[model samples]
Target: MDNHDLVALSERRQHQVDGVLTAFFRESHYRAKALGTPYATLWETLERNATGGKRFRPRMVMAAYEALGGEEPERAAYVGAAFELLHTALIVHDDVIDRDFMRRGGLNVSGSYRDIATTAGIPLPVAEHRGMSVAIIAGDLALFNAYRLIDRSGVEGALRTRLHDILDEAMFVSAAGELLDVDFALRQRPPSVDEVVEMERLKTAGYSFEGPLRAGAVLALASAEAEEALAGFGRNIGIAYQIVDDLLGVFGDERDTGKTTVGDLREGKSTVLFAHAVGTPEWAEVSDWFGSPELSVEQAQRIREVLEAAGSRRFAEALARDFANRAWESLTSEALPDAVREEFRPVVASVLGRVR
Candidate 1:
């Protein structure tokens, strides 16, 4: 399909997926209302949090399914919604872990709750605890609902089993990746660039890219060869996506990205840039500010300057391009239908082109 047609197709598929999600959230809100005020509030916050995303995961599922000649668009839309729920689950948990209170340029679930508590005269520490507890519950609900959506998606027998396996592996590998990220932050020694890359692959790629693509391919009953080829392409592109994300975390505008650029620096995130900056003279100059909670704007700018001077930014950009190249190469595999390959070209381009 041409670019115009592709954009139209994506919009239609996304609309289908959005319909499923809207119904899911509506049902959830009623269920929560039947329980209590707190439950209703939680569901309401989660519903809000789930909206306003790029909805990229659902789009990926639809793209792969249609490209591989899947017949059931509605069923695919349900599965696509499942992946978007998974994205919500992971990010809600990630915000708690990262101590972030904002998402999509506004107060997140935890932040909203925390604010409510403080406004009601609750102690700061207690309010923070309450917020985190509510966020944890929200994340768990999202995760469980993701599985529930898939189970009810009307795919039977082996196909259903394979889809669950894909979800299982995605969660499993992602948990390991999260642990590595936390561990790297606490450890005195910084991780190697290779280790950081692997961490990014496990944390972001498995679920965000590979699992979604492979799940769609499997749902379509694509051959094993074709499935693996698409999965590989996803892995490469996902890694590139995360690397650029890290770059944006440090360098992009908060207004545009809807996130604080200095959060990674203050959190001392062991990103690829940090790995490259280790042992560099420029990094040493601003190393003291790396993880300080009181890290100021001036300090952040200085660190950015040092990172630029150290060529860490350059290294990360090159690494991202390299992975994008690998993704493009994966599309060339004979196992992938030409239509499937063509569908993903702009996807790879978007990854390379994303500023946020």
Candidate 2:
């Protein structure tokens, strides 16, 4: 298909998935209402947050399915919605772990609850506790709903079993990565590049890309070679995507990225970009500022300059390009159809954009 035709296919698939999500949320709200819990607002918060995202994971599901020559767009829609729900569940939990009050420039699930408690004149500590409690429960609800959506997608028998196994493994792997992230944050020493790459594989590549692609290919009953090839493609591109994300976190305009450029610096995230500069002489210049919440704009700028001077940013860009190149090469596997290869070709450019 031509680029225009592919874009149209994406739009149609997204529209179908959005419809599924809308109906799913509506039922969830009603179910919450029946429970009559004061936490009915959780559904509303989830719905809003779910609506705000770009639906990229769901799109990946559909795209991968199409590439594999899956003829059932309706079935793809069901699986696509399931992947999106999983993403929503993870993002909610991630924000809670990060203690982030905002996402995409608006109050997150925890933030919404915190605002309610604080407005009611609750003590700061008590309000914060309440926020955490609600966010945890909300995240759990989302997590379970993801399974429910996939189970309800009607991929029966062994195929359903395979899909479930993939989803379960993805969540398990991602959790391990999150644990590593927490461990890294608490460590006195910086992470090595290898550790960073492994963490990215589990945290991002597995779920965000590989899992979705694998699940979609499974639905298409793709051959083992085809499945392996797509997994490699997703893994490489997913790492590149994470690298781009880390770059955006530190350097991109907030207006463009929809996130604070300094949040990652303040959080002391052990991203590949940061890992590349560790132990370098220039890194010593800004080591003290690495995890400080009190990190200033000037300090961040200096750190950015130091990272650049140390060639960390360039190293990260080069690494990302290498991964993107491997992803492109994976598409050359004879197991994948020409249509599938063409459909996924644009992902390379999107993954590794021009570094400023």
Number of the top-ranking candidate, with lDDT as the measure: 1
**Deviating ranges (above 4 Å) for candidate 1:** 354-356
Query: Model 2: residues >4 Å from true position, as ranges?
Result: none
C-alpha local distance difference test of each model: 0.90, 0.86
Against the hidden true structure, what lDDT does model 1 obtain?
Answer: 0.90
**Residue pairs with backbone overlap in model 1:** none
| Weakest lDDT window of 10 consecutive positions for candidate 1 | 347-356
Alpha-carbon RMSD, each predicted model: 1.7, 1.4
Say what the RMSD of model 1 is.
Answer: 1.7
lDDT of 1 by residue, 1-356 (tens): 77799878888998999999999999999988999988998998998999879898888888899899998888888888999999899999999998788887788888988899999999988998888889999999999999788876888888899998998899899999999888887888889999999999998889999999999999999999999999999999999999999999999878878888888898888899999998688888999999888999999999999999999998999999999989999899999899997899987887778632
Residue 231 miss distance in model 1 (angstroms):
0.4
